[model samples]
Target: MPAQSANSTSPAADRPPAARDTDALLRAELGTAIRKLRKERGLTLVQLAERAALSHPFLSQLERGLTRPSMPSLHRIARALGTTQQVLMAAAAVPHPDIPVGSAHLVRSGEGLPVARPGGTARMLGAPAYSVHPVEYTGMSEEFQDYYDHPGDEFVYVMTGEVEIELQAAEGPRVHVLGPGDSICYPGGTPHRWRAVGDGSLVRLLTVQNATGEADRHHS
Candidate 1:
């Protein structure tokens, strides 16, 4: 047998600096957009942070692209910015597929806009003009227990790694551990959570949600 390399399979090794930098670059691009929008609206960082209910330091880091914000946090920020989350998410450096009336939407490889989140990065694939809201999430294995329920239906299909999906049932909570290629669909009204399994393992899945006039989402 060949000699084993030191920690070749470690999570840190798996996640190269280039990938991390790419994520950071996207965050930086997003931060620049937020800053430009904030300036255009004549709102100081303090004012905007207060309006978003986020601490100034946190907001500063976010504006500086020093950290990533979760989807909920971004939602709050978008509310403070007086803009929709989708609009802000669409302005990133990543190319967006334009799905117009009676038109074909084309998305070239590496054109998807990626929004970084806790333990994952989400890419918005569907537009407001579409009948469905689709986002692809890539997450690294970590300890997480976020739960929520919303209006409409949702579908999830795993593309890589493993995950444990927890769904709130009348009896209690049903758990389903899934591997690559597995899929699940259910109503968004049901409370649920998904957690990555195995240390350093990365999980990727596509989520499609109902895209009506508007959908109410309550997070816990």
Candidate 2:
């Protein structure tokens, strides 16, 4: 199949009407994440803008998702929020499949809780999150405090655009470029990172993290 185009119709269009409301969905998800994190840190919009080196109005626009931020701008916001870019990326999501089979929960298109750091929106498929200081874990997850090595499995499936997941091995390092529908999974201890593969076009993924013996068995 051809590589998915960023300017093309959203993949969600082929799914259901509930998924078609993507533009607004993206903004709501991103805005909600920023607002939640800011409140958690007890910093008002003005203070956060100052700390982020962004203007108050622009920050407000960001919180409202009226505009998008470049990756560098997101990095600044992450630092100002006392978190990592990856954490903010994770803020766009929350999930743990260990609960049950068929819970009937639904996170709409581009409607994942904002991972605390800042980036693409995310909704969890499985694997719960850990708690951190100064940032309480509310029932509605929108961000992570930080990432640590823990016992669990990870699976990231590219749904749009392109990505490269680099993994370390005895031979040295390896890179796997994934397009839409491509996925990679690794154990918890394996160190890895995401890299841009092409035009740095926007990419989305269905991320699954499972911390259970069953998942180990499945992967093994």
Candidate 3:
């Protein structure tokens, strides 16, 4: 069978009216967030689609609030936008506020924007538009995971418990173990992964990632 357009929404047909409305609202909000990020980075619809390896028409539909992207597609778009999927998801939770330079957005205790992570709890600690995005993590993956690479630098500081961080170096893969008060910083585009050191224990980390690099803008 031929592939359906990404804008197709037959699955929502069987849902109750209220549920469909909620879904539509979410799609619209997410679409707006995507569009804003794309424009802020001076990218066109076709440019973003090419970077994300998606169809131009589909991306147009997504930005127009006519469709929602799947998780994989969303991840691709997030990477192409020089940001993380978690940031995009959290930003969509509320209207994007316009704050002047030197202004601040306050998030009270336990009110940080939630970010989904397997076997861990993550939340965005800074506003989406901030030059440096900060996310707090309270747990670790049950097992080692694939290396993750993105557009900007990432600095991780372990606040409690033991943590293991692996970085892919030109020589080979290098692993570092850290306890409280230890930190590591690496440039963007470096492949890296991390996990808690011990069995079923609490580990806390604060990660701050910078804005996209010049190379990412021209090539990705």
Q: Global CA lDDT of candidate 1, please?
A: 0.64
Over the stretch 1-220, how does candidate 2's per-residue lDDT look in tens digits?
2211111112233646754445445555556677877797899988887787776776677677565454445656766776543344444433324434445334444444333223333233221233211111112112222223334466776766676666776787787878877878777556666654454436556555543333222211
Best by TM-score: 3
How well is each residue in 37-146 modelled by candidate 3, as lDDT tens digits? 89989999988888888888888887876776654466678888877655565454433235444466655555443333544656666655556667788788756766
Q: What C-alpha lDDT do the candidate models reach, one value each? A: 0.64, 0.50, 0.69
The most accurate candidate by lDDT is 3
TM-score of 2: 0.42
TM-score list, all predictions: 0.60, 0.42, 0.63
Give stretches of model 2 more than 4 Å off: 1-22, 25-29, 50-53, 70-72, 82-103, 107-153, 158-163, 167-182, 186-205, 209-220
lDDT of 2 at 158: 72
Candidate 1 structure quality by residue, lDDT tens digits, 124-207: 665434555677788753665456555547888989888888898889989998888999998746988788888424788888
* Candidate 1 off by > 4 Å: 1-52, 56-69, 75-102, 213-220
After aligning candidate 3 to the native by TM-score, how far in Å is the CA of 141 from where it should be? 0.9
